[model samples]
Target chain A: MTKPAFIAVDWGTSSFRLWLIGEDGNILAERRSGEGMTTAAQAGFANILQAHLDAISAPLDLPVIVCGMAGARQGWVEAGYIDTPTSLAAILTGAVVVPGQSRDVRILPGLAQRAKDAPDVMRGEETQLLGAIAADAKGEQIVCMPGTHSKWVRVVDGRVTGFSTFMTGELFDVITKHSILSHAVAGAADMPADTTAFEAALKAAFEKPQLVTNLMFTARSGQLLHGTTAAGAQALISGTLIGAEIAGALSSAGQGAAITLVASGRLQTLYEEAFRSLSLPYQTIDADAAVRRGLSAAAEAIWLKNESKS
Target chain B: MTKPAFIAVDWGTSSFRLWLIGEDGNILAERRSGEGMTTAAQAGFANILQAHLDAISAPLDLPVIVCGMAGARQGWVEAGYIDTPTSLAAILTGAVVVPGQSRDVRILPGLAQRAKDAPDVMRGEETQLLGAIAADAKGEQIVCMPGTHSKWVRVVDGRVTGFSTFMTGELFDVITKHSILSHAVAGAADMPADTTAFEAALKAAFEKPQLVTNLMFTARSGQLLHGTTAAGAQALISGTLIGAEIAGALSSAGQGAAITLVASGRLQTLYEEAFRSLSLPYQTIDADAAVRRGLSAAAEAIWLKNESKS
Candidate 1:
């Protein structure tokens, strides 16, 4: 059996995932929980990690590699950020070590674009980008990483030129829960998703994204005027937001740059439908696999490869 | 003392304002309260309105004319809607009287655009439109009634064309209060308004309104990357929403239609600033005066003018 090499973890603001990798890059064990940075900050990151590691009975000496909000300022140890226009390789080298750990533990830094006109930052998606796009790949590429704060990164050759963060997911959450439209979409979760409303709204918003807020109001108005289903209202809101995101993401991107979407589950389904509705050709990479691969690459560079060389 | 001709009230979703108008069209008495439709729905609209009427020491027989959410389906009385492409005169004739009221109390109907592709409805603002624009106003005119849900109406040759509703204000409220960026704007209300930041964000979003969600994220990223103040984050979010609203409202409007703004207090100030920043010429009408005038017009058509004719 291949010996355990290192543990790769994705610790986001509200979620935690850990994987024990073998020497050959095979996953030996896995664990996921809600004890992300927020919970860990209160319960102690070290104790949570130990409990997860103990559940899998992993080697005590195995080092751990982490990314995402675990490295945020209010996170575990403030892993900091690597400013753009920097190479994906810079992310691997900027990992900050957690001092006095029983085993070697490091958190990958995020990327920040400090442009006055269009400032943006990403904590975990940089690693996903690091793995999603090949380091030596040529030509311009637009990589879309969708989540609570969906990020659209512009990659020129191997370097990350810049990126923009669209508050699509969080906006959807708040608007549907807190706005008057909340009443329109109250029973949506129990109903089947409305792809018809989704596609139409996606097309309209993609064509005239400035009218997005106006379009959102239609969710309520549509219900009142035409008895639109609660599910339709929910889908309409989602499509309008995602449609605007896609339009904004490509607004300044080089024409014909390949669109690579990195998302998982529901977001993946929605974005794919949006791309198809807009007739934009695109490719997809599973977000979980990409992040694990990115973390694996970082682990090899930080520990496994170094151990072999020595 | 001039005899009270009628009681004009603008009873909105969350606020109530009443004015006792004299026979010669002057204000004889006034009252304001938080007992809007929401509260009055539970406390009883008749009781609340009568209490205000009694407090002003007006004669018990003075009839009341109301326009706003009080006319909504969920409001005190379902006064219903006058579909678009009808004359503004139709609204004056559409008032529904409260059946069991001690004196004449009529609620003005809202406007509804039942277009399948762009459905919209507005309750209070049609009355504002009736007051803001002259009956024989020639050429195309665009009226903006800014509030929780801002309404932009199009009128051509004194006929009501169509309108769009943008959820800009509610979005600002929810986003700043519930989203992740809420942390970025926690103390913004205590800080001085950041007009500089507001203008910069306004121009950016106005120029590329599709990038609104992305621009909104900058509120948080700006603080993380450049130490932008809480007030600046608040202003940035506000600017982005308003900027997108303006762009959406005019995307298909006829070029150079006279812009009339009917808004009061803070919204009026902010919208005026936005128009100035965009170099769009516009004239302002006090929202209070417009609504009051509107109610008065409905009263004259319903009772006063009819009384004189008799």
Candidate 2:
């Protein structure tokens, strides 16, 4: 068995994932939990990390590299942000070292676009970008990372030019839970997704992105007038949001820009289906793999190569 | 004072407004309360309506005309709907008489567009439309009624063509109260609105309606990057929603269609500003007066004129 060399952690707002990398550059062990920054902020970030390290029986002196909300102001440590238009490699140099730790710990900084009109910031996803694209890649590339707050980033010749965050997933959650659409989506979770309703809504919203809110109202109106099922309503809401997001994201892209979709599981299936339905071409990248590779790059740049040189 | 002729009630989801109309068509007495459909459903609709009637010293035999949510399926009575592509007078004839009442009480029916692609329904707003536009008015007319659920109706040659309901106001409310943007607008209510931010957001959204959710994220990113105030964030959210709504509403409007804005109070000011910012020509009408006039028309059609004729 390959000996564990370092730890890679993606500590988000509500989720935590840890991977122990061996000397041979392979995942020796992995752990996932709900002990993200929010939970760890209350439970103690050090204690949580220590417990996971203890469970994995990792080397006491092993260096740990972390990314995501753990570096946010309210998280474990403020790793700060690297302003655009910056090369993806700038993220490696912006890692903030944890103070007074027995084992070396570093957290990657986020990316901030300071444009007055389109001000935007993203944490964790920057690392995913690092792994998803090659440093020497050519042409304009649009990377879509779908999640609670879906991000659409524009990269020109390996440097991130700009990006926009669409509140798709979070909006879906709130609209179906707190808004009038809640009644329309009740009993939807227990049912299978209605693909036909989803694709139709996706096409409609993509064509008339301005009518997003009106399209959302159709979730209830359709149920009332067309007798659409709860599952259909849920699919409509999801598709409308995603469809509008895709339209907005692609609006600023350069003509013939390649699309790289970084997602996994349900989100993967949904976005791939949306791309097909809309006839938009895109390449897929495993989100977990991308983030892990990003952490690996940061790890080697910060510690591994430096240790060998010393 | 002229003798009281009839009672007009506009019972909405969360508000109740009643006006005692005299024989001369002037308001003799008025009562406003929070006993709208939701509250009335729990506290007894008939009892609530009778209490308001008693407060105004209304005669027992005096007839009543109702509009708004009170005519919904879950309200006082199911007043049903007048399908679209019909004369505005159809709404007047579709009034449903409430049974088991000593006094003659009728609830005006709503308007429903049964288009499979864009099914929509409007209760009180239809009555507002009845008063805002003349039945025999020629050409195309677009009515903008901004509220919790903003409604936009397209009318032509005295017939109601189609309408759409945008969940703009409701989306703003939920996004600000329940989503991440909630933190961006924490203390906005106590502060004056930021018109600069509002106008900028309005134009941005109007130009790129598809980028709405992405623009919404600027409410937070602006604060983080530019130190934008809570008021500014709130204004941005409002402007984005309203701007997108206007863009969507106008997308389907016919060329040379006159815009009739039916709104009052804060909504009136906001929408008026939105229209002016976009340089969109619109004539304003008092929403209260419009709904009242509509209720009066319904009363005259159902009982007042009929009583004299009999």
Q: Candidate 2: which pairs clash?
A: none
Q: What residue runs in model 1 are displaced by over 4 Å at the alpha carbon?
A: A307-310, B307-310
User: Could you give candidate 1's per-residue lDDT for residues A211-267 as a string of tens digits?
Assistant: 999999999999999999999999999999998989988897754888999999998
The per-model DockQ list reads: 0.94, 0.92
lDDT of 2 at B232: 98
Stretches of candidate 2 off by over 4 Å are A306-310, B307-310
How many residue pairs of model 1 clash at the backbone?
A: 0
Quote the positional error of residue A194 for candidate 1 in Å. 0.7
lDDT string for model 2 (B222-258, tens) is 9988999999999999999999998988897753687
TM-score result, candidate 1: 0.98
Candidate 2 Cα RMSD after full superposition onto the native fold (Å): 1.7
Q: Name the 10 consecutive residues with the lowest summed lDDT in model 1 chain A.
A: A301-310
